[model samples]
Target: MVKDREQNSNKEKKLLVSLIWNFSTELKLILMALLVIFTLATLLPFIPSSFSLSASDFRFCISRLSSVNTTTTTPTKLSPENNTTTELVLDRVLDNGVIKRTFTGYGSAAYNFVSMSAYRGGVNTFAVIGLSSKPLHVYSHPSYRCEWVPLDPTHDPVSTTGSKILTDWGYGRIYTTVVVNCTFPSTTTPVGGNLILHATTGDPSLNLTDSIPVLTEPPNSVDLTLYTSSTKKKQYDYLYCGSSLYGNLSPQRVREWIAYHARFFGERSHFVLHDAGGIHGDVFEVLRPWIELGRVTVHDIRGQERFDGYYHNQFMVVNDCLHRYRFAAKWMFFFDVDEFMYVPEKETISSVMESLEEYSQFTIEQMPMSSKICYSGDGPARTYRNWGFEKMAYRDVKKVPRRDRKYAVQPSNVFATGVHMSQNLQGKTYHKAEGKIRYFHYHGSISQRREPCRHLFNDSRVVFENNPYVLDTTIRDVGLAVKTFEMRTIGNRLLRTRQ
Candidate 1:
């Protein structure tokens, strides 16, 4: 295993080198040099006898150098962002079932391949979660890495594309998280083939060293005419894809969340948790029981911190999670551990999900709750002693106009997704999911707190300056039942300590 890893590492290093040594960039430099010499010769006759280089003259040459394309290709293909990120653990599963593929850049653009799905009698499409916002040319053809051989000779490749910006505050000259919906002709079986995105001017087939491999679903997946009685595709009800867990996290809250969601989603639901750095001794201990039960999956993504992509590289992590478990689940939920997902009292979990199954994706509204504030009107603070969701039950009275809503998607339909919602999905998306379902956003509940009750209000109407207060103990009511469930399943010893 060690020897194989070494060989693969060596191969990756070679691929990185080949991407850096771009032919078109070198040619541009040579052409630039010729222009400089020609321009200098043309202006020589105008100078006086004792003509020498001046500061301004030198500045002109330096300006010329700036435009000249250098061999220092920071953008690359199928490579890590920088030297520090070389230690990132990538699952290079070249099987047809594999979901995500990432690339640095092939000179002009970078690509973070989330996954690809193919359909017969239509188009073959791939989702790139993060890439340069600038438009790109894709080698969607399965066999050719850079060659754009269309099934029909007249079909325009440039017209078929989709994109959505996932960045809030901008980073200078870096890769931005965006959705890409580029397609190719679908008929030939992909069989885990390779494809690349490039700005190749010459024959694209020549620059095949850094093509990223993709996982394509069978055409029969979406094609009705190709139905087979013997087809035994695995199916799941609900799957989770969470953001990177970092910083000091509240283990008490994490434990309750795991237990609650596990029960909330029932036996078949599987949660995929990414441990960027936060899942420490206590958090890991809390996750141990769920991990043992095979209900929770922990991916150690600590190395992804090297790339300062949006919010601890969370967009990349979630996109990876999506593609990684694309076909495995009927519906995939994306959110953070800090938030407790709650199905309202009126709605049953199965009925709510089933009702919304007709839509490709639905956004869950947030009931932003306070982490520090508590409702003393119910009783003294000592009376409530279950989980963070139980004790800290104060919610924001004033609703913010902005949409910080989380969402759930039928993975098979979505091409690319954001932290808040999904894009390029086949079916319509329901943006307003207020009464049907929503999540309680406990703002800073993930951080460890000694008391948590900073200001105990008498009634629900009492408002603070920025932190308006209102008592909504709905989840608090459910937290008690979850406590009982935890006591039975994970053991009372675990719950007793938290109490």
Candidate 2:
């Protein structure tokens, strides 16, 4: 009876195996599909109805459940902040002990906070803020007293009193910005910098502490509270404030740009590179040398992308850079990495600027160089051997009408700065910069990583548009000089190129 039962079980097992084999992969696939569908069905109900899922996101989920899928996805509207309400993005402590906080505040009033910085300027202590918001109630807290007191509350902030929007220029920004200034009582000392917030006047929300500079007269009375300025020795003569650099940028181009600028500007020059997304992959390696030399400082501002502000929060970037280094540099140049600031031959940039010390701000004229057009020696094959400028020798000589301009400024005189020029300040702007200063713009070339030279021109008959391409080998020669300088200074071992 036991043997008979065993035979019957073996026969049944064989029959099942035969059925599966005859159906080919159909049976197996159907079972797997059903399993995946069931699993996704279980998870689908748990996910929130309002959760946003892009096409790519759905593709990712499908890949995870590759055998089959059943999850029903519903898209939701997301603000610049990843979260719905009141998300704090950046809370960085500045080098001078002032704390800079950036938040995605809760509102639909179109009013938003960018940043507020408080520092002692000469005899008075003042706060300079860049934002588009309600009249902020300013508060100052002395370390000794350990209390927050209103500086300018119920005051006529509506009227102009050392307060103005740096510039009312933005590319369809959700929150429009203006400059709001309030002075702290000179008698009181701060633990950190002064606290300025947007709330009902005199009603403080959150309290935080920081350290600032102390006074020698009242040593014991005023402790180290709001120290926002560096000593004279730590200051720089020249500072470069870059815009929000984003997208796929050429690593080698970035390398050449930094090396060339550093070489051109000499030592005493510092570059503030705000990386929105561009500084990735080998780009970091390219900048690592300058960063080590203290010539370059890269800000990882990728978080600002979520905010639907004017071109990756460009205004805020310039303002932050200006305020952060307001006391640091004697002269600051606000421009782009793609735009190379150039002075005429035999004239040092310092000397060129020294001549125009009377002016508070000076704009640099743009030399729009063609990316496709190049001046080649012997019709060389397309190769990444030479730098972009070294190969790209043609610049359009035709004068085009420009609405915007890049500028250099004395940040101390600048209350707030915009993308093009700093207007809300103390002195005259020098618009007549003809032979002294200008920038070489390899238009849309920074975005090109590999091949810079699209076409080589041996003749002057090349006409892409009405703009005439001339054999301006000025910057090209400079590129060669930059290469030589790099080899001499950086050496062969520390440097590496991708051919």
Candidate 3:
């Protein structure tokens, strides 16, 4: 038995040695190949540049895995949560120098990969990396206020073929100036003059050429322009309010919700605040500019209506008028200021609109909103370390009983007394989507000193329970009383009631 065990140990050692040898050999080969490729890339600057390639064709990768399909069983094809992010690190060795790095990564993920290069006279410095992906849409980042002007293909009217190019201006605070260069490719045609550029941020129809002059350069395939003013950068169309004002809510938590909500809606979407109780002035002051330009607008309605000073309601209203409000936008969602919506399969609000365009109205898919009830005081200063729902002053509101349900049927009312339900309905058909295809109800987590908001039921998919005194109650289904603040998280549904 001892001899056999010794033999087995020797065999394992041999296998391990062989595996190590093979791995080393593979690593050496990879390094050698990378070195050869780098040498060839170094010679690119000398190869008399070609001006025949179209701007679109200049983009390197469009692998077979990047296309959208309705026939495939997998609904989520390319979500940021599931896919690997392609990151490019830009390092600066000198105090005042620029670097430009150009390498291609897969683009089918929401945004396109970026190629950045820094320059100092004849010497090419370090190149940093960035993206123009779906989530990082429009090539703009908080680090730099980049601007893109997409070229229009329909300028000539008489000619069928046209070219497109996007210009970017780095953030103004850190970077003193922004430079734009339009270049024709080595594989396509000489695209010049007749190109049109438009800004899609605030006014999608706002043409930049009407306000400024577009200088036309040479046939060498490079046209250069620059923008120096930092304050004039483009911003999103909706207001983005910080949950920091929600008192106890952490900034990190708010960031997660923001990222999830932004991606779920459509990559470059913005948000605004509607603090009904008016406890947070800082959040409003910070997001003021977006409000002024209508790029991001807030609707503060604290004193708009008061219900015996016991409760107030806060909600967000998004006006997506830039994207053909009639077609691109089919319906409006009215959710509690705390609640958010997320759909499965990388499905965006625009994509869903396309799917529901066939039907006139539909029910939104519902997710139950929940959180640990705190036992401490109602103010933000209260700590939840020892507090638990069992010791709290308030109990989870219940659904009301049948009768006295007339107050629930008003069309203007968007939320039920309890948790509200939703369906992605078109005509009469209703079906359940995955939790990935869900909306979030985040009220429970954001309780302030005065209770920031009351429930609202504005979507077409909801109806109230059949009880009158049951206001602020929670019901998982229809035919119950309305209760106050029952459904705090996702997946809860409000039943319909008739007047």
lDDT winner? 2
Model 1: lowest-lDDT 10 consecutive positions:
113-122
Q: What CA RMSD would you report for each candidate?
A: 22.1, 15.4, 27.3
- Candidate 3 lDDT, tens digit per residue, 69-135? 2222322234478585444443323334433433333423321222222111001111112122223
Candidate order by lDDT, decreasing, is 2, 1, 3
Cα-based TM-score, every candidate? 0.63, 0.65, 0.27
Off by over 4 Å in 2: 1-123, 128-130, 133-172, 185-194, 199-234, 381-384, 493-495
Cα lDDT listed for each candidate:
0.66, 0.67, 0.31
Q: Per-residue lDDT for 168 in model 1?
A: 28
Give lDDT: candidate 3, residue 83: 89
lDDT of 1 by residue, 1-499 (tens): 9999999999999988887686769878999999999999999999897978789999999998889532233332344455343343323444565544444333534433322221222235555444332222233221222222333335433323233334322431244454444465453323233334432223244443333333333323454322222244535689999998998887777887888888788887899998889988888888888888788999998875554456677776777677667777888999888787888777777889989978999999888888877777557746455467777778787856685889999887766567888765689999877888889888877877355676777676657776567778888888668877877877864653341
Candidate 2 vs. truth: CA RMSD? Answer: 15.4
User: Which has the higher TM-score value, candidate number 1 or candidate number 3?
Assistant: 1
